[model samples]
Target: MSFYNMVQSEKPATLLEIWEAISTAFTHNQNEQFQITDPRHGDFTVHIEQYADFSVMNNIYQPRQETLHIPIRPQVPSLLMSFCLSGKPGLSGDRWEASYEANQALFNVFPARNSTYVLPANTQHEDLVIKLEMHTPFLEEFTSDSDDQLSNLLYKATIHEESLHSLQGNLTIDQTASEILAGIQKCPYTGKLREVYMESQVKLLLVHQLSVVHRLQHSNKPDTTAKLTKADQEKLQELKLYLESHFLEDHSLQSLTKQFGLNLFKLKYGFKTLFNTSVMKFIDDKKLQYAHLLLQQENVTVFQVADTLHYGHYNNFSAAYKRKFGYSPQLLRKG
Candidate 1:
């Protein structure tokens, strides 16, 4: 019942060939809708669709009783964008361990090393992954210098492979990204139209993710006033998690500085650097997102939801909700 079969094969020549090779490496089950044929790999479901310059792989995998690690060596350099819709997968490289959780995403610029993907035991994992091979050189043609984070990252990975190794980082997917991913999944176009739709979405997603990287890079520029140490980065991340869990609680810079033993300047700059948003904006986003969910699912009154989220004034809560979601809470409730 385990789906951790390992298969060793030659590197695939083309993107389509890579998909075919992956399909051929896994076992097929009668009850499963998707299966790869290579018997050494365990049974799993994967749907591969190819476009002009990119390919998408929708994967749902579950290792029966033990964790499964698969080594993938791509013949050509590529940029991979993986969106974790559900489940958690472990990724290990030279000295790092990355766990992709639900609603999170990762962008990787691949070098010439073998990449390992670990699927946890007895748990269903689902991911929407798109791979853009670097052989085409289309990205540079399309992207301008001002908005060239993706292209720049790809160029560095190609020309300076030793210095770069493999560039991998986790990205925080906000509400807009979640909606865009959902739109891609529920695309209604058919035939060539579907391909066009998906290709456009892939580009948009890339741009959005790259913009995040751009912000981080800009914030981390060599400015003495904005620089943060490794410990400061960790402290900022910890504070971010704390705010996420206690979004409804009142917070201020002075209180957070005292609570976390961080200086005011570091508290403010480090937060914006790491999250690409000010602390208050981040808190408001989380609170409004939770309120939106409660309105849609819990059958609660707008007033009740606002009260629970610590919005003392109903009108203020409605205004904030409108600003965030483009509609009033009452309208959402009615709809």
Candidate 2:
């Protein structure tokens, strides 16, 4: 086969069957310490596993001293995404290392497997693996950049070290853990839903992880003269803080423009470009944050906070807060 496609076992698979399938799919060679098992689910046996000293079986083989190496390349070309459910390497020889806890996920494109590979001795590798058979066309659609090349998106050896650090930290499971887990659990890997579900989950996870890293790495980044400048970004941040502080005040574009010496065009574009949010939308977010905080106040009322935040009506504030937090503010307050 040109690529490793989905495996739909007619009957439930055993440990040995799963082992052979995994070996044939991922590693080209590895030490005996490597292991695989059946990850049992409702009426299904998926190849959810962990292995040590994993590498390509094609050429020479190098066994890891302590850490496990996950050779994601199959008998064919593929894209691999993994989450470190637990365990991490203390060090990585590869310039790029994605070290995230349960909150993070990794994305990499595998051209093919090699016979020899090495992993750090200090890091323990335990991860949840997802492999997709080589799909040149689908990859092109998903990738942001156009390139007829094989590259590892998860680990870029030449990327900035600080960005790598932030990426690793951000990949771990965090606020969006439930959404990710739910998406994975619901993926059927068949028919119409297969690609759609897989693509959605992958994109969401990747976007979230990258967004966090981007924020950490360039929180105060300036806008370019050709585009938005750094000063423009700083002004936007200041504007956001101001909105949060005076959410209840009259915040029309005209009022803000007059006070801040910003034109309507600049205000609209600058807020969107710098903060990735609209002016009124950002104001709404601040109101929500305040409402969340106000829930902690023993004597505070939802309507009172809503009015203080300049919500035209109490229901509007409640609905918005509910939509953002997934629960009614009053209910949250009572809790």
Candidate 3:
């Protein structure tokens, strides 16, 4: 095994230097999973599976000394989506650095990319990375007739080296997306069948994330009417992330305003203006949508799911679910 020790203050090593240290340094047994405990590499069991369409890398590691440098070929013309299933790992890219904190889903596309993830000390980290490589024709067909940021990402990366924040999209792993992600982890197929299942599921997950970016892109355009500055709008975006992470908790408008440092009017009105949904409604929808996923399981009853969601009354949860979905909560199980 090979190991390189370096302090954090030094300049980041180039990708080639990193590869010499880690990627081919150790010989792994031909199993679905293997161990990499080469001191500086940390102690981790990794499952790196490559299928016909895309690839998945599942790493469960505990922090040791020295930051981890992962080196490999750049999967270009692809959307790389990463999830921190557990632990709060700190990640910094050689180039495209956005919010790489744990519990956040960050995805972006480029012709080539490099990243280094520093798993926090004393924490158990489980991260799943999904790379959806695309062909020229497939991406071309998908982005045609659209001038959205996604299309802009494809066009910009083709000619330039700079990365934009919007294109380096960061998001919360909401209920539905989480479900899709779970499906990927528990995929049952093997061989070519496994490839097809993974490809389809990853595509679905990408579409789900794209829909979110598309909505937020349009909803957050300068109100032209409100006195909100660009900074205020950015804060509102941050506020949305906060709400998504804590939507199940009981939070009053006053408390939320204080937490986000927005006044009563902007907390209510600006949320409405920027997100196109009231704060309370936004929270309620997230709750009910999560409830929908839980109810789909035959083992869990509606009341049990509602209680887990902190719903004070079963009737209120059911009514809200019915209102949003146009059917009673019981119908999902029956169907």
Candidate 4:
């Protein structure tokens, strides 16, 4: 049987209850730790931590040529933010379907409904997921202290505003977001200090995500500028994946325009609209990501890594790497 099938006996009323049910279903090694190894699912490790009003679940799922589905029936109004560091996970509702890919974030508000989270086959999934139950008192307090329009929209959605159908959107993870997530994952503190650090980082992630939504809303207004069709958006997304996969290749605006069969204006605006980043910056981020991985995981020198990624000068590569990750390649390699 699949992991979800083993644990689908009861409906969980809260996030904590959900974790408890899952723990009961799986072999618990320690507090907040659950593991299940199946032939179909490969291996799964779930760590859930509960705060006063929220919960954070860190999941690492590796599937072997099979898909896994977990059904959730949330019993309260809650906001969910899922940060995808790798792999693609699909979320399907009664009427909608959303896919979150690597280096992207998704936010959605649920109103005590049934939904299914699908982990696609043949991939390793690493995700940091946060669930915040929206009580009336907390929502009021949060809105009163904030001037951001996106926060206001969230408040209205939680209270069931007629103007908004659902609070759901996807955002590209920029440098600031990447750093905050990295801090959360690689916390250097322990005990109470670690808890405090996690709380602050979660709050910061919320702030940054809300800001991205606000900026996207303002930039894509009806009367503001060019509007891309669904097809155009898909094409741009394809281009983004291509760039990520070929980060070491040399690319220029003219080359991209001709290769993608898109005009300069549409290419620039469409990419920015869909990914929330310029083409060149996106490529740079991808390259730095690969460089960091090579330095940490592979047995390679800094100079060789730089050369492989097509850095014309070693100094230039070192400077860009330091700027992106706040440390020199030598330091990262040393560790």
> Which residue pairs does candidate 1 place in steric collision?
5-42, 24-38, 25-38, 26-36
Candidate 2 CA-lDDT value: 0.50
Taking the tens digit of each residue's C-alpha lDDT, what string does model 2 give over 124-239? Answer: 34445554444444433444353512123332421211123333333334336446756665565776666466566655765565554445446575332124443554565577
Cα lDDT for residue 296, candidate 4: 77
Off by over 4 Å in 4: 1-31, 136-140, 145-148, 161-169, 221-335
Residue-wise C-alpha lDDT for candidate 4, range 51-162, written one tens digit per residue: 6666777888776755766676676667677888789877777887787777667877755666777778788888887777777554565566457686686677667722
lDDT against the true structure, per candidate, is 0.67, 0.50, 0.64, 0.70
Q: Assess the local accuracy of residue 139 in candidate 1 as a C-alpha lDDT between 0 and 100.
A: 56
Scored by TM-score, the top model is: 4
User: 18-110, model 3: which lDDT tens digit per residue?
Assistant: 444334321221224555454453456667677554567777877565445454435354556778777765445554444444545666653
- In candidate 3, what residue range of length 10 has the lowest lDDT sum? 22-31
Model with the higher TM-score, candidate 1 or 4:
4
Q: Which stretches of candidate 2 lie over 4 Å from their true place?
A: 1-21, 27-78, 89-101, 115-126, 132-135, 144-170, 187-191, 210-335
Q: Which regions of candidate 1 are displaced past 4 Å?
A: 1-33, 36-43, 93-97, 143-154, 161-169, 220-335
Quote the positional error of residue 266 for candidate 2 in Å. Answer: 35
Spell out the clash pairs found in candidate 4: none
